[model samples]
Target: MIDLPIDLLITNKNKDKTVDLILSFLSKENYPAIQKITDSLMYEASGRAFIKIQTGCNKFCSYCLIPYLRGRSQSVPVSQVVRQIKTAQKQSVKEVVLTGIDISQYQDGKAILTDLLKQVLTETSVERIRLGSVYPEVFTKDFLDLYSQNVVSNVKNGRLCRHFHISLQSACDQTLKRMNRHYTIKQFKKTVAQVKKAIPGVSITTDVIVGFPGETDQDFMESLQNIQEIGFSKIHVFPYSNRPGTLAGQKEKKWGEVFKKTKLARAKKLRDLSKQLEENFRKQFINQTLGVLIEAKNKQGEWVGWSDNYIKFQISNPNLKRNQIFKICLS
Candidate 1:
């Protein structure tokens, strides 16, 4: 244990002062990202394991600690990933999600996501694959070329045609600059435009940080407007946390206390907007039959899983086993 301090402020859904439990966001815990993917695949998985090919980021965005915490851009090697996918086939797992702290940046020589995709689809027995998250800058022409023409054309099997999370932190150029994000709003828009043109019904999701110390109302409004315009399938919104050893953490000593009340209010608002966006996004997929890998069965007796496009499916199949893949009709 790193021995987390007991004084950490724990809160509640109501935003009121609360009790303890450092129960991390399961998605970003201290656990190895690879293990997380594997566990999700083995237990929570409906049918396939998530293969984490890379760890860490060299980008070092001002607000992120991934470079410090997860370490630099080292890959798990393509051969290893291929081996794991083969094991997945023996387990009868039908899908594989390519995950990484920086999935788009995974590279070793001429091979990148394009090369990885070609291998997984053409060589592997996994029937479907979905990306974890990718930086927009990494969504190169090779990616667009495949994602566009393929209305499932280039896919050999188990590779998604129109899905990716493009980490759009903010819609305002100024906000993006302050956040140390590499791409501008214009660049992001241009990239997304090409993706949309290439793949109809592409699900582009993003992350937006609200209440950065210097963000003005205009900046906030601009981010919201951009979210609406992008028509994101899901928006993972977070209130900026001033973690130690980072630039934002360094500023915490100088800048006055961030209004916890206000920032949470903003997060809540954005979450509401996110749900609305997801609802609208889901409407397009009503009656859609998507390849689903059953992850876990809830206590409510509903077995749920995510489609290749990451659309959640709540199938009411009680006898279904976890880590099994099936094509389920999306309502």
Candidate 2:
């Protein structure tokens, strides 16, 4: 086994200072060092790219280790983000996903995520802009107002996709409180309502965790009911897992654990509910015209792409190339 010298700076949240320390150490040891803080624009051969505008997380949820691992939030300058998007556009990239560890907390000087979005719309010629997962609490009225203006009614020319995947760990207030999620179920529903009102036909997707420690049957039922009522286009259900060094993990270690069979049963039930909800959402678009971005041909030689609402679609056209946008009626 090779032994390597490794130093961790968990206490130092400033990335710049961390880099400086590493460089100084390397220079003193007469070792060559190269550093690049800003990431270069990357274009996939399929004409898609992901632009990271921020990094780190400050939300210390009970079950999440992200805060400990990533430290506080730090945003990339809007100018840098716009520069990368423009470069990707020049390379013929049709879609770009604005990603971050916690995008809702993204801020560069006086500009927030909404401000950065406006600049991207005004400056870049990218066909579609997809946002990564965002926190529901950050969906303020001002943000929604901004979104209402730029969201393209016509998918062909729309720069922003009509899909939002907000993180909702649990719908039950008690369970959410235990997880330290920082928002109530009612607040989440209100945000969802606001989003749907601002952007008609917008698809909302979410993440749900079941069988968290101390969750009662009543809590699970509440979660299930709320999930069904929300009518998410897609639901990603995950069974709670104990992550080392997390608050939940420590608590589980101290207390008796829930039965594995029980957790599995809960997960399966939520997954079934998710499938039903997805089908229901899909049925709503039948015979309706939707815009799709042709990504690639599937194993059966049928062209496949995602709609603006993030629906997977199979087109009969064999002549279509990647990155081309086409309108089709869902049947």
Largest TM-score belongs to which candidate? 2
- What are the TM-scores, per candidate, against the unseen true structure? 0.80, 0.88
* lDDT of every predicted structure (CA atoms): 0.71, 0.82
Q: Give the lowest summed-lDDT range of ten residues in model 1.
A: 11-20
Q: What is candidate 2's lDDT per residue for 146-245, written digit by digit as tens?
A: 6676675543366688899999989999888888998899999988998999888889999998888887778888999999998898889888889989
Model 1 TM: 0.80
- Residue 287 in model 2: shift from native, Å? 1.4
Candidate 2 TM-score over all chains jointly:
0.88
Over 1-331, each residue of candidate 1 has an lDDT whose tens digit, in order, gives: 5977644333211122121123443334432212322221231235656776877789888788888776787666666678788888888776667787888888867788778776765667566666788898767788777655443423444256367888887788877776788988878888888787777777888888887756667778888887788788889998888877888678754543457787788788889999999999888888877766688878888988876666888878777768766767777
Candidate 2's C-alpha lDDT? 0.82
lDDT of 1 at 65: 85
